[model samples]
Target: MARTALALREAESAAGRLRSELAAGDEAATRSAGSRLAEQADVARRHSDGWGFAALTHLPVVGDDVDAVRRVARSVDVLGADALPPALGVLETVRGGGLRSEDGGIRLDTLASVSGPVTEAHDASTRADRAVAGVRSDRLVGPLSGPVADLQQQVQELDRSLGAAEKAVELLPAMLGAGDRREYLLVVQNNAEIRSTGGLPGSLSVLRAEDGRVELGKQGNASLFGLSADPVARLTPDEVDLYGRNVALDLRDTNLIPDFPRAASLMARFAEQRGQQVDGVVSVDPVTLAEVLRATGPVEAGGVRLDADNAPRLLLNEPYQRLRSNEEQDAYFQEVSRGILDALLSGQGDQLELVRVLSQAAQQRRFLVWSDSDDEQRRIEDTPIAAALPRDEGISPSVGLYLNDSTRAKIQYYLRYDADIRSLGCTAAGRQQVVAEMELRSDVPDDVARLTEFVTGDGTYARKGDDAMNLRLYAPTEGRLQALTVDGEPAGIKVGQDGDRQVSVLPLTLRPGESVRVRALFETRPGQIGDPSLQWTPSMEWGPTRATARNLCG
Candidate 1:
C-alpha cells in the first residue's frame, strides 16, 4: 500500500508538471517530466502486482483495500506506459523539426508526423479510462482507503486532461492550415466595456496562416464596419424583442447573440463587406493579452512599455486618459496589437511561455474561437475555447450571471462584482431551488468627470462618475426563475431567451462610491446541486475573484 501510494503521488506530480510544460510549448521539459512519470508508474505497477499483494487481496478483511491499491496502480501504469509514451513521442517529433523554421515558415511535413503518435496517445487514454471505471472508493475500508480513493480521483482527472490534449493535437494541423491557407478574423475585446460574450469588440484584425507562417493583415476599430440600419440576420423573436433591431447594427454588438458561432458569422459578414473574407473568428479580451505579456516579457507599443503586471491597466484604462481623440486611441490600440504580434512571430521570447499563457487564457474563457470549417469547429465544440454555454444534459445545471455595460462607456473599469449561490431545497416534483445574489459596486472617483472624453464617454450616454449596467442572470435550459429582487425590493426584470438559456435582465445605475445588491431565486431540474462554479467576463486589472457558496443540501 505504501509503495502504491508513494508511486501514485510521484506520478501525479510529474504528470502535472508535464501538462504545464506542454502548455508552455517546452518540448524538452515535457519529455523529461513524462519520462519521470513513466518510470514512477512502472515501479508502482510492479509493487502492486507483487505476489504478496495478490495473496493479500484474496484474503478476507482487507481485500477491498488491496483491490483499490491494485486498481490505482494499474491506472498509473497504463498512463505511464501507454498514454504518456505516445504523447512524449509526439512532443519529441515537434522538437526535432515540426515547429516553424528559421525563415519563419512552418514545415507541414513535420507537423503531419505527429498524427500517428497523437492517435496512439488518444487510444491509450481511452483504454486507461476503461481500466479505472469500475474502481470505486466505496469498496474500500480503513485508513488507506481515503488515500486510495484520492489517487483514483487524481487518475480520472489526469485521464480527462490527457484526452483533451490528444484531441487538440489531432485538430491543430487543420487549424494551422496544413492542407491550405486559412484566414481568420481576430477581435480584441475590451472588457472595460463589458458585453455578454466577454467584452465589447473594440479592434479587429485578419489573421492568415499557411503551413506554419502566420501573418496579421488589415486591422481597424469596430466602428469602421459601419452599423446596419436594419437587422443583418434573422433574429429569434426573443432576440428582436430583448436586444431590439440594433442587434445586427455593428460588430460591437454581434456577441449579444451569446452563441459564438452566431456572433462569429455576423462579424464575418461585416468583414466580408470590407473585402476581407475569413474562414473563422477568434476573440481575446485584455486579460488574455495580459497573460501573453506575462510569457513574452515587457514590450514597447505606441511608445508605451507594457509588462505583464501593467498591460491590462494601461491598455484598458490608460488609453482613455492619455489620448485626447478617438482616432489617436484607435491608432494606439492598433500599434499595441501589431507590436505584440510582431514580437510573438519574431520568436524573441520563450515559446514555452507563450503556449502556457494561451492555455491559461483559454481555460478562463478569455480567449474564444469559432470556425466556419465544420471539421475544425467540431473538434473544438466541446472545448472551453468554443465559448458555448452549458447545454449538455449530463452536465450539472448552473446559473449564469453575466454583466453587460448599458452605459455605453468604459465605466466598467470602476465596477467591482461579487456573487453567491445557495442550494435551498428540492420540491416534490424533483425541482431543486437555488438562490443567487450579486453585488455591484462603483469605485469611480467623484472627480472622474474631469477626465478625458474617452474615459467618461463625455456625456454621450451617462455622466462620467455613474455606471449604468444591464445585469443578466441566466438559468439552466430546463430551469425557471422563481423570484427576483433588488436591494430587498421587488424589481421588474425583463425575461428573454438566448439559445438554450433563460435570461432575466435587470438594469442598474450606480453613482460614484455606490453599491447595489440583487437577489434571485430559481429552480433547476432534479439532482442535488454539486459544487457551484462561477463564470464572468474577464476584467482588465483584476486577477481572479471567487465567490463562496452554501450547499444547503448538506
Candidate 2:
C-alpha cells in the first residue's frame, strides 16, 4: 500500500508539470508528457481489466484474507482520491485558456476553438489514466491471488470501473468539439404583387437602421406589411446570451454548432480555407412561421440546389409555359417578357416560342409574350391576308400584298377571345335579345372615319323583316364615337344581333334612312351571277367584328 501511494504521487507530479508546460505554450514538452501518460494509462487499464480492485483488498500480507482485503481497500481509495486533485488541476489549466482572436474582429477562427476540444480530450484521457493506475497499483502489491474463485471475483469488479472510465475518456473528445463551420443561409418568401410589402429580416441595412427608421409614418399606410420586430438591432449582448442559452434567441446562434465565440472563429477559418468572404447572420419570418426550417446554402455541397428561378422548377415538374393572366404575368417577369423574347429570337436558327396571355384592361383582347433567353431576337411581322389564311387546294387570291403599302400596325394579328362573353354565362333578361355576327377588318388609316362613312352616309343598306343591328358600348356616353364623324355622321357604331338588345350594324350598300331586305353574300359558286354579287345588306357598326347570339321575337 505504501509503494502504491508513492507511485500515484509520482504520476500526479508528472501531470502537474505537463499542465504547467501547456500553459506556458511549450506544446512540445506537454505533448511528450501526454504521450508518456497515455502509455502508462494503457498499462493501468490492462491491469484493471485483468484483476478486480478487490485484488487491492488482499495486500501482500499473510493474515486472514478478509481482513487484509478490507485494509487494502481503504488505503487504495485514499491514494486514488489524492491523485484526483492533480489530474483535475491539469485539466483546468489547459481548458481555461479559451479561444483568443489575433485579428481583433468579431468573427471567430476555427484554430482557436479547436484548441479547446483538443485540451479537453487530452485532459479526459489523463484522468482516465489516473483512474486505471490507481486500480492497477492496488492490484500489484495486494493479496488478490488468494483462491482461484476469489481472483475471478476481484477481476470482475475492476473490469466494470475501467470500462466506465475508458468510455468517458473516449466520448470526451467528441462532446468537446463543435459542429460544421459555415455561413448560415437565410430564406425570405413573399407574395408577388404590384408592390413588395416585406423585406429581408437580417440584411445589413435592417440591422444597421436607427430608431424610427423602419416605422410607418402615416395612418392607413400599407407599405410595412404588419411585421415590426428588429431583433438584430434591439437585442443587447446579455439578452442575446439569455436567448441563446437553450432557446437560441438569435437566429445566428442556431446556425452555430458550438458556443458563440468558437462558432465565429470557425466560420472565419472556413471562409479563409474556401477562398471566399463569409458573413454570419440569423433570420426570422412571420410568413412561413409553421414550416420546418431547412438550411439555405450558398455553398453547393451535399446535393443542395437553391436559386429563385431554379428552385421553383424543383417543385413544379411541368415544362415552363407562360401563365395566362396579364397582371400576374407582368408581375413575374417585370413586364420584360417581350424584350426578353425578342432577345431570344435574334439568334441563328433558333425557334421562337410565344406565350399568349390576356390583356387585363380590355376583355377578350389577347397579347403574346415570350420567355427571356440569351439566344435569338423575335419581332412581330405582318403578312398579307391572302398568304396568312390557311391554305386550301382551291382558288387563291390574285393580288400579292407588299409590306410597304400594308396597314400592319393597325390590324393586330392575334385577336383575344373571352369565353365569358361568347358563352353568355350570365342569365338573359327576356326571350328576345339582339343577335348579330360579322367578320370585318379595316386597312384605312382612320378606322373611325372609315366606319362612319359606311354607317351614316349613303353606303349602308337595311332590309325590312331582316333584323336590324343595335349599338351598345360599356362607356357612359357615345361622345368619342360622335367626334370621329364627318358632316353629322357618327363613326364606330356598336352592333347587336337582333333587337331585344341594342347593337350597331354597318351598311353594305344604301343611302341614309333607306330600307331594303338584307342577306349575307358569299361566292358559293364562283363566276355564276351578275357582277358575281348576291343580295347584301349592311350592319350599322364598323367596329371589330364579334359573334353575338340573341332571341328576336318578343
Give me the candidate number with maximum TM-score.
Answer: 1
Q: Which stretches of candidate 1 lie over 4 Å from their true place?
A: 1-18, 21-73, 92-97, 126-164, 416-450, 459-463, 483-492, 509-521, 527-534, 541-554
Residue-level lDDT of model 2, residues 1-554, one tens digit each, is 33333333334444455444543435456566545444433343333333453464355543234333333333333323333333344334334432212221111243343444444443533443433322322223342422212222222322322232233233322222234222221212111100011111111111111111111111111111212233222333432332233212232222112112222232233323434333331222211111111111111211333232343222111111234342432243221221222221221111110100101100110111111111210111111100111111222101100011011111111111111111111124221111112222322233233222212222233321111222122110110111222122444533332112111233222222233321111111121111110001111111111122111111
Model 2, residue 415: distance off in Å is 82
Please list the residue runs of candidate 2 whose C-alpha ends up more than 4 Å from where it truly belongs after superposition. Answer: 35-54, 58-554
Model number with the top lDDT: 1
lDDT of candidate 2 vs native?
0.24
**Candidate 1 positional error at 179, Å:** 4.6
- Find the 10 residues in a row with the least total lDDT in model 1: 545-554
Candidate 1, RMSD to the unseen true structure: 4.4
lDDT of 1 by residue, 1-554 (tens): 77766776777677678666766657678778878877887877888789989889888867866876677667767776777777767666554544557865655566567767777776776676666655555456544455555555555555555565566666766777877899999899888888877788998888888877788888889866647666667777877766766767777888765667777878887777767778999888877777777767889989989887888778888888888778998999899988877676655465546655665666666778888888877888777677766563643556777777876778787778767677775677656678888888887888874666666666767876778878778886667788998889998988887766688888888889998888989887676354344455555544432232433443
TM-score of each: 0.82, 0.18
Error of 2 at 269 (Å): 24
